[model samples]
Target chain A: MTQPVLEVENLATHFFTRDGVVKAVDGVSFKVGAGEVLGIVGESGSGKSVTGFSIMGLIDPPGRVVSGSIRLAGEEIVARDDEAMRKVRGKHLAMIFQDPMMTLNPVLRIDTQMIEAVLAHDKVSEQAARERCIEALSMVGIPSPAERLVAYPHQFSGGMRQRVAIATALLHRPKLIIADEPTTALDVTIQSQILAEVQKLCAETGTAMVWITHDLSVVAGLADRIAVMYAGRIVEEGNVSQVLDVPRHPYTRGLIGSVPSANPLGARLKQIPGSTPSLGRLPKGCSFEPRCASASEACRAAKPDATDYPDGSRVACFNPYSLARAS
Target chain B: MLAFIIRRFAQALFVVVAMVVIVFFGTNVVGDPVWMMVPGDATQEQVEEVRRAFGFDQPVYVQFFRFLADIAQGDFGRSYVHGGSAIRLILDRMPATLELAVVALIFAVIIGLPLGLFAGLKPDHPASRAIMAGSILGFSLPTFWVGLMLIMFFAVMLGWLPATGRGPVTTFLGIETSLHTLKGWQHIALPALNLALLKISLVIRLARSGTREASLQDYVKFARAKGLSPRRIVGVHILKNIMIPIVTVLGLEFGSLVAFSVVTETIFAWPGMGKLLLESIQRLDRPLVVAYVMVVVLLFVTINLIVDILYSALDPRVRLAGKSE
Candidate 1:
């Protein structure tokens, strides 16, 4: 029922490195509606972070969005020049990095950075920006935000610093936020706390979020929809609960089954048999063919098309669990 | 903060005291330097006057204590050559050296910093490569040769500026300084630029490396992600982070500029402390020589203190290091 804020279609980002060309994000597509939290779940190097970077136009040299269409509302933004992207960045869209220190300039005070971020998009005076920055900090549950504004980033704990990063992302009330493992470095308790706070924030503000992470439990609790990635493609995607309970694609199932809680007590967690395939030398057909339990000859011949089930789940596998059972 | 400053000052004073002892003994005890210090081929009367100068030629310890007492009152004894305050003569010459060093520093920073920043931003670009190659020449070429070439072109060939002397001295802030009028600027410009050549090269290398490293930091990426314009991100975010090291190097370089401007000063015939120092060495002016060495030591400590203060101000983490988390 909500309006769509982001639509990424057939996006492929690649790195033209000295050694070889790497398909960082190959033909990935997803959409997030207003207030919807779309969790992009995957192992490291699965193109999850690249997908986030591609959407934000944060790709640096040797790596670029080779072929893609990214639209915010109706604006085609994939190839927009940096000046134009500056207009869209921090206003229509924002990003949260994995490390808060990366977001916080060490020599600058928290207030200086936050106020500058506010002033970047708004034509407000410094007094107005300062007030807004303070309010933003408090909203993120920072105690004595005025004092915190004067403190340096290193003065704060890692969790508090990430909270500051989240606060900064919320400053413009951007339509979409691409957070690349923002709390993967935090303690578990801090991770849950940040997730809950952010979830509450999106619920209240109706901001769409793309949370890129390797943890399934994190997405299970926060996302409205989950997209499971393998190598550089979305292997399976569906409503979070449905995907977690009955993952159609073998990669998604293996991911869910590997979680300690999903396994019966004392049973060794089930892991996918082989490591993720390197994108440059991916196997023909399915990239996961080497590790697939249900892989058939057809699965190795070519990549399979994503099949839709009556339950509204999509799986990119030649022999999906639900389809196999139906046969 | 006051306590921290006081502690650092006390530490600095301790170092100065240690230096004073070494310099006093080294200069006073070596080769009958006092005898050497007596000018005009000391007659018996002049030699006796030297003894009376140390309080009736009091015992060495008595003379040392009296010397210390006089130093505490800002009297560095009288110059053997001029028979005036050695400290005042050094102070009189200080402003000229300071002016040249400061002008060189200003030119170096204003031109070198931005050039280095661009070079770092586009390290592989043709223009940046040219800048780097130019800096290599700056580093390798001799300063004396560079000074001669500049004089030959600007002074000899073009006849735009004067060749020598601090032209028509004017006093400002109760200190004598060269006139900023056309003549004064013309007089100092050549030597200042020549002295700056080496430092400009130093600053360029430092800024380039610092910019390259800081630009890759996460905060720089974050600045870009904030949608800050490229100018703002590089100018503010990147510049502030890289300035710490540059400031450190600049402080040390500034001290070297003051102490080592001897060659440039001699070449230009600019009457700065370095030139005065060279003259005092020839005269074997004991009090003046000791005072000059001590004054330079003092300059180094004071500069170090200023740099530390500036560092703590720019980087709060350094200021709050042991005080809080």
Candidate 2:
């Protein structure tokens, strides 16, 4: 395959707080090729969002990307200064936040917001930028894009607002777009509609996407590949169907098992034994060991590094579930 | 929007009525104006004659109704001490007080906003801490004492500025103002600064808190992610949001500055409405005092209305709310 649009390797984003260092996105690595959708599945505080922020170079003080190499289209992201990084952002990469209502500035008109997003990357005339904004808006399925552009964010429904956000992200046609649960705040119906629209946009535009979400079902329908995160690390990474049908990582298996549809009707829903461990003081061996049903003596002794399997799956475990045994 | 303003005006009228009632009764409680007008050795017959002539012998409610009717016709009665139409006496002084209040407000906002933004942006910096400490002094230091200290240092010790009075007056468009002259600004500077101290402190605190709160909002973070320059992010996005609250507080404060800048005006002998108010109260000039207070009430009502309008302009949500109403 050609070079991936985004490549993040051994990225360690840590927050230096008063109590201790929080390894929010410790040793996370992933790749996204053109038109590919990589869904990062994890619970809250699993560093899924932080990973996105790190890629965008939007991490504020008290939190720093302590160690990592993030490359966007063969350009090193971690090496750029703030000014240079800003030039890359919105031009080469963009972000779509979860809460659409809060993402757009309430006082600013949709056109104003989108026009600025365009002007930030391109030096085109305001009229030209605005036309691009209108085009982008209509591409996201918004009706009467020209009129909608003049309206403030409050005038739009939650779904429409997210569409506006997506339009803003697509304004520059950046190489990569990090969507951090963009549809999570909308109704389920709206969520699917947005999901379909986003999927189509990604395919038509050939823009790479890192769709960070907590819902397994969302990634199942949207992502070509899936990466399961625990604590702060991707414990399983593989083709979506391969990983879903036969999850090698115990955590991944547990997650798939816990889904209601995966279990027989009227049967007890399978659950992981315990909550995700805090990043500050994770277990010595595996971060998921305390809750892992197949945890072994070796799993308790040392942390497991990711190992590649023949079927193009990656599992980070000392004793991963065997596919033959499951079948 | 028109309905909103009309409703606010109605509320303002009610407030004015309440003020008139309270001010009349409250001044009456301070003692009869007729006695204050009379000499110390006046006989009962002489006092009675004077009281009847001034209509002071009438019942309190009757006096209130008469006063209300007089004000409705733009007749604010005569100042007992100044011996002129009370409204005229106050209106002549209005320009000075308005100028001082506006200049003081400008001083407060210009000096406070940037400092407050700095402190908010870099809260842990030593310079920010010093700015915060200076703001605390601005809040706690008595205005009169600050005025005195300013006089001592700038006027008495340095002889750089006039110690008292509004300097060379320029009449522009039938109104007397000291602003057109250079020496006039020097004279007004100390007094305006003294008046602005507390307000500067207030704006600093308000801006600081507002900035801190707004910087945490999701929209601000999103602005950064949009790759907008930091200057644009803070100046446009963050500043605009924080201004909503700051405008509100400063608008009301401007009214108070105009109405009750008594100590600064007195200390500096600035010859404004506040000084007029103080003298009216001291001499028990009921008509002058009442007129001054009513003017202040009008000023406050007008200011509050403007603030509400400005608030709607700044926030679209407020504009929509006004539309619905």
Candidate 3:
């Protein structure tokens, strides 16, 4: 089989503060094949966004990747210097920020910013770059791509701005696109449109994607596979139907159960019992022990190692679910 | 946008009229113009003659009306001490002051803007910190003291340049003389540097603060994430956002440069409007004094107007608001 498009092994990212070190992404391991949409679902501070940022080399000062191997298209990216990393970025890998305004500059016209992005990685003529910009914008469903390209960022609404940002990332047809909650800022209908467009474009280009979001419903509708993260670690990961329908880890089960659609109508939606453990003061055995309902004495004494299943699912739990055990 | 300009112009006209009213009555309340203009040994009849000639003997209201009428006709009356038309004297002195200010502004902006941007981009660097400290010290020192120090070093001690008197030429008409060429630059250099030093410090501080804020803006972070080089991020994205506030501070400081040049001109005895205005005030030349103040006020108003127009051009939000209104 061809090598996975992107692979992360034992990736650990930490934040150092006056208080202490926050283990944001303790040990996240995952892989995305070509044309695969892998969704990482977690609450705020679960390190979902940090994992994406780490892969993209966007983590700022005071927070850094402690130890990790991030291989993009079979090359180690974590060890590359800033210049090498930049070459990979926007060419082989690209990202869409959560806030659309952050992705677009208010002072510059769309054409100026988009064409510059195209010209940065390629030795293309201005006319060719302009044509590519229009095609990208139109591909994202923007009307009058030529005229709209001349307009500044503020002239567009929030959803339109996000579409433009996605268009910019798509200009190079990168191998991997890490979207850090890109749709969280948009309304539901717009979110659905953006997600559909993103999925269609990725499939057409055979691009791998890591979608970081807290919305399980979005993952259910869009992701081909799902990795459930809690307190900086992935508790369970598998093909979308296998994990979402029959979650092995208690934490994953609780998350799937908490979704409104999982509960009966007019009933109080089930909620995960406790908040995520603080990174600095995490439980010694398991980070999610305080919140998991099936915690046992052994689970309290030692962290569970990841156990692989025959169907390609992995779960880190002392007591995992089985069909016979459930009966 | 045109409507905004019209509104600003109307507001400026009101301010000019208010300034004229204050100058007219304030000069009258100070003392009798006749007594102040005529020689001390002049007889009462001659003093009365001077007062009648200026219409100072009329009621204060009538005198004010006549003053406004003369101003409207572009006649600023005659200078009692200089024995020339007040407007002509002021106009003659203006070019010298304006030249000094324009050159100093160019120097301050050229030096201060880059220094500020560099300091902000690399705040922890030793060179940036040293420049920040130096700008603070430069801003705190008085202009006259700075001028004196330059003269002592470049003129008195080294004897590399003349010590004083605008240039080697005694007559103002010989301003075009060889003395006013390269040597004249050496003569004016100290005063101009003194005037520019404080402004440089002001611009540096303002630009640094503006740049720091712009650097933190989301678009700057976005630019970084876009994989653009650091040079492009700092030069294109961050600098453009910072320029609005820096331009505002620079415009106001440039206007103040006109007024502040008075002290530098006095120290160096430069042939500028500030020096002329100081001489007129000492001699109680009321017409020249009023005319000088009006000129300064008009200059400040015009500069502020230009800044406002540029503000709209630089920021689309401002332009949109202007269009809406």
Candidate 4:
């Protein structure tokens, strides 16, 4: 079998603060195959965004990838210096940030930024790079690519800016694209449009993607697989349909149950009890034990190792919800 | 855009008029101009004659109108102490001051921008920390003291460069002029260095803060994620973002250079407008003082206007208002 496009093993990112070390991402591991869209769904501070940033080698001071091996197309990026890592970033891996406006330099024209992105990686002619930029913009559904190229980031609306950002990320046709809540800032209609475009682009180009967002509905509609993270660990992993339909981990079940459509409308929606455990002072044993309804005394004794199920799903819980047993 | 320019010009006109009025009446309030210039005893008729010649004997309103008329026609009256046209004295000395200011500004930008970019890019790096500490000290030290120190180190102690005077420009302007020759630039070296040392610290502080802020911006992070080299990130992406603020502070500093030159030029005895203005003020030359102040104010206003236009060009968000125009 061909190797996955990207693989992360035992990824542990920690932020050393004055009080204590905040385990932003602890012992999280996942992979994305070619043309696969993997969604990492979690609330803020759940380490989902940190995981994506870690993969992109973007963790700055105070927070660092303490121990992890990030393999991009079989090359070890975690061990490379900053200079070498930069060479790998846009050429093999790219990222779309949450704030579209933040992804663009306000002073620069859209064409200049996009064309520069292209020329940075390739020794292409200016005209060729420009044409490629226009193609990328148009591919992302931006109209009048030529005219819009002359416009600045402020000229475009919020949604349009996001599209332009996506266009810039795609300009290099990188092997992997890590999108961290790219659609979260847009309206629902625009969000859906961007989601569909991203999905279609990945499918057609065979680009492996790690979609980091708290929006489960978006994941269900777009991602091929899902990894639900809590307190810097992946509690559940499976195909999207299997995980969303029959969530095994209590936290995963609670998350899906809390969604409006997951439960009946007009009824008090089931909520995941308790907030995410604080990174600085996470509870011992299982991080999710205090919030899990089915957690037993054994669950509170120690964290459970990931147990693979017959349906190719994995759950990290001592007392996972089983449909057969529940019935 | 035209309307904005018109409005800004009208505001500038009001400021200039107000400045002229203050200078005109304030000089009269200082007592008899004749006595102040001639020193010792002077007859009442001599004082009255001096006052009348200056049109001070007329109504204050009429005197102000005459002053405004002279300014409109580019005639800044005559200097009683120097016996030269006040406008001519200003024009003659203006280039020398501007030359020093321009060179000092260039030095400030060249040295400060890179230091700022380095400090910002590596906030925790030892070099950056050292630069930050050094710049703080540089900024806090008085300009005159800095000038004296440069003279002591580079001139008196090392005996390398001349201590004073505006160095001959012809030799410096020549393409073949080398440091080995030490002909013209050697004389300017002390004054220029003195002026730049203080301003460099100011520019570095501003550029460092701006660059640091720009580095944290989302676009910078995005650029990094795209795998652009750190060189490109700092040079192209981060520097451009930081330029707007840096340029603003630099422009203001450039304007202040003219004002601060009063002290530095005096210490160095350089033939610049600051020195000329000081002489005029000491001798109670009202026309020269007014003309000098007016020229400086005009420069400050013009530099600020240029900086504003540059600001919009550097940051798209600023130019958004232009769309409405």
Candidate 5:
């Protein structure tokens, strides 16, 4: 098998504050092969976004990847300094932020930003960079790519702005693209359109993707594989269909069940009994123990390591759904 | 863009007209200019001759009309005590003030911008903290007190530079300024440094805050994410973005320095508009005083207009916003 575009192992990003350390991303492990999309789904504060930022080495002061090995295409990136990390960024790996504005410079023209991205890592002439930027723009379905290139970000609509951002990431045809919910702010139609365009782009360019989002439905449609995160840890990992159709972890089951379409009309969406556990003050044993219905005394006695199931999905639960079904 | 400029110009005209009214009536209301013209031995008839010659004998409203009419012809009347046409005197002295202000502003920008940007980039760095502490002192010390201390240290103690006065002037383009000569440069150096002390700190603070804000902007992060070197990020993105505010503050401060250099100029006796302002106000040289204020008003309007143009040029968002407006 070809090597994956990215391989992350035991990644733990922590935020140190006067109050206490917030374990934003604790022991997240995943891999994305070229041309594959791995959707990381969880509610807000589940560390999905932080995971992407940690991979990009964009985490600011007080928030750091304290422990982990992030390998992009076989090289370890976790311990790289800012300068070394910068060289890897946008060339080997690129990121699309949640707010397109967060990726677009407000004052600069689209072409200036796009071309700069190209020239930053490549020894290309201005003309070649410009050509690449225009091509990237049209590839993402922006009409009048030439005119759009001359325009500032504010001139583009929200959907178009996101397309521009996606286009910029596509400029270098990076091996890995980590999108932090780029379409979450858009309306349903625009979101789907951007998703389809991005997915199509990734497929065409054979670029691997890590799409972080809180929407399971989005993952069901777009992701090849899905990793469900809860309280800074990946609670479930498997093929998107297998995980969505029959989640082994109770947290994954709760997430899938809470989707509005799963519930009967006019009924309150099914909710996991309690809110997410705060990372700093998690339950003694399993992070999800207080919220799981079938949890037992053993579940409260120790944290569960990821258990590999026969079907190839992994769940970190002391009393997983397979056992319950066997009984 | 043209419409914006025209609109700004109209607003400026309104302000200048209002300022004309204030300069005429505001000064008149304080006391009569006629009082300064009177001789102690003059009889009532002699006093009336003095009043008529100076046009103070007319009704207040008529005097205001005549004031407006004289301004229309660009004839600022003769100075009461200075014994010269007010406009010519101001024009003659203008280069000296410009020279002093230009030197000070140069000093301010050279000393302030990099330090400000550096401190802003690393707010917690030891050198940054030291710069901030020095800026506190810069902003705290009174300009005159600072000026005196500068003279004491550089002139009295070291005897390296001259103590006072605009020395050994050179003529250029019909303007007399000491800026061309080494002695002249040395003479203006201490006063210019003194004048720049507060403004330098002001620029440093402005640059620092501007740097902080610009560094936090999304594009800067995007730049970092693009793998651009730190040099490119700070040089191209943060610096260009911060130039708008820094230019604005510099323009306004430069204008104010031109008109309001009373303390710094007086302390160093540099012979600028500020010293002229103090002298004209005391002697009731109404024409000179009004002309000085008008020049100041003109400088302010021109600087603000320049700042707006620069703002639009630096920020495409502003230009696009102007178009939408």
Candidate 6:
């Protein structure tokens, strides 16, 4: 098999606060091949976003990668220093944030922002860099690319702003892009348009992507594979269809069940029984056991290791739905 | 833009008029200028004659209108003490005060901005703590006392700089200044530094808070994510955002510094408008005092206008806001 564009192994990011150490991302492992999109699904504070930040090396003070291995395009990134990471960032990898309004500097012109981004990695003339920026803007479907370059970020609508951010992420055509709910703040129609644009860009450029979001429907439409994160750990990981159609983990089943569309019209939405436990005081056993309908005595004794299937599906629940069905 | 300027000017005019009325009545209530003008043993008729001569015998409202009329005609009357045109005395002292204030403000910004940026960027560092501590010291210590200590240390002990008075003066750009020569700089340095103490602390606190807030903005994070050098992120992204607030506060501050630098001027014995105002108030020199205050009010109005214009230049949003109006 060809080398995957991104390979993360047992990545754990912890925040050392005065209260306690909060394991934001603990033991998350996934891979995205060229042109493939991996959707990390989790609720807020479930470590999904931290996993993305960990790979980008953007974690600030008190929050750090306590243990992790992140490989980008066959290069080990965990051991790289800030200076080395900077060269890798925006050149070998890039990121798109949730709020486009905030991602771009308000005071700076589009051309200034984009041109400086290009110059940061490549030593190109201002005119040449400007041309590349113009091309990028057009690629994202923004009209009058040349004229738009001189406008500030506020001049654009929210959707257009996100498109600008997408264009910037694609400027270097990095091997990977970590998009953390990039469309979550946009209107539904604009969300679909940006998703389609991103999908096309990835396919055409063969850039790997890790799209972190809590929306199951978004993943259903965009991701090739899906990983369900619970309490900072991925309890299930598999091909999008295999997992969505027959979720092995009880938490995954609960997630799919809770989706309003997954239920018949007029029927009540299914809900997972309890809230996510705090990472600092999580149980020794399965993190999802507290909320799992199929939880049992053994599930409370020890944390279950992932059980892998020949079809590449993996579930970390001891008594998964598949096993119960067979019995 | 024209409408905005006209509106601002109208507001300024109204404020100046209101200030004139207030100062006119306020000074009358303080003490009669006739007493200050007459001798201690002057007879009642002599005093009465002096009062009639200066129109002090008239009612307060009548005197206020007369004062207003004199101002409209560009005649501010003579200083009872100096016995000259009050406007001339204020204008003559203005250059000295303006020179001192400008130099002090420059010193404050130059020293404060970098220290504040450093403290803000490395908030937990020992050096940052020390910088903050120094700023606090600047804030707490009285300017007069600090000026004396500076004189004692740099002048008396070290004998490196003069203790008091404006040094050898040179005229440049048709304004008298001590800034044109090396010796002049030495003379201005201690006084300016003394005046700048409070302002320095103010700017440091402003810049530090601004930097801390701007550093957390998503654009700054995005700049870092773009792999831009640290220098560009802080110098361009962070600095540009912080400058909006700093420029605004400093602009208003520059006006007050010019109008109310009495303590600093007294400490160094600089012949500035603030010192002149202080003396005029003591002698109950009504015309000069009123003229000096009116000049100060005008100075503040002009400065506010300039600050508004500069605000538009620094922030594009401000320009748009003006346009929409």
When summed lDDT is taken over every stretch of 10 residues in candidate 4 chain A, the lowest stretch is: A318-327
> On residues A1-327, what C-alpha lDDT tens digit does candidate 1 reach at each position?
544799988899999988788898898888888888999999999999989888888899889898979999868999898889988888889899998766799888888888888988999999999999899899999999988998889889999999888888889999999999998889899999999999999999888999999988888899999998888999988899888887888888788778898779998788889797777877768898889899999998999877777776778888888745533
Report the Cα lDDT for residue A66, model 1. Answer: 89
Inter-residue clash pairs, candidate 2: none
Please tell me which predicted candidate would have the highest lDDT against the true structure: 2
Per-residue CA lDDT of model 3 for B1-325, tens digit only, reads 6776687778877887888888778777776656767788999899888888877789989988988999888778889887899978987888778767877888788989999988887787899999999998997887788889999999999988876666544345633232346876787667778889988887788778878888877677666666777788877788778888877878887889998889988888878889998888767777788788889888988898889888878877788777777
What DockQ results for candidate 2?
0.78
Query: lDDT per residue, candidate 5, A110-159, as tens digits?
Result: 88888878888999899999998889889999998988899988888889
Off by over 4 Å in 3: A323-327, B29-48, B57-62, B157-189
What are the per-residue Cα lDDT tens digits for candidate 6 across A79-138? 789999999889988999999999999888899999999999999999999999999999
lDDT of 5 at A168: 83
Residue A174 of model 4 has an lDDT of 87
lDDT, candidate 6, B95-138, per-residue tens: 98999999999999999999999999989999999999999999
lDDT of 1 by residue, B58-90 (tens): 676776777778877777898877889998899
- Candidate 2 chain B worst ten-residue window by lDDT: B1-10
Model 5 vs truth, CA RMSD? 2.7
Judged by lDDT against the true structure, how good is candidate 1? 0.85
| Per-residue alpha-carbon lDDT of candidate 2 for residues A88-147, written as tens digits (9 for 90 to 100) | 888889999999999998878888788888888889999999999999989999999999
Give the per-residue Cα lDDT of candidate 4 at A264: 85
C-alpha displacement of A90 in model 2, angstroms?
Answer: 0.6
By TM-score, highest first, what's the ranking? 6, 2, 4, 5, 3, 1
In TM-score terms, candidate 1 sits at: 0.91
Q: Give the lDDT of residue B240 in candidate 5.
A: 80
All candidates: TM-score: 0.91, 0.95, 0.92, 0.93, 0.93, 0.96
Clashes of 5: 0
lDDT of 6 at A255: 89
Q: After superposition, how far is residue A182 of candidate 4 from its true place, in Å?
A: 1.3
| Chain A TM-score vs. truth, each candidate | 0.96, 0.98, 0.97, 0.97, 0.97, 0.98
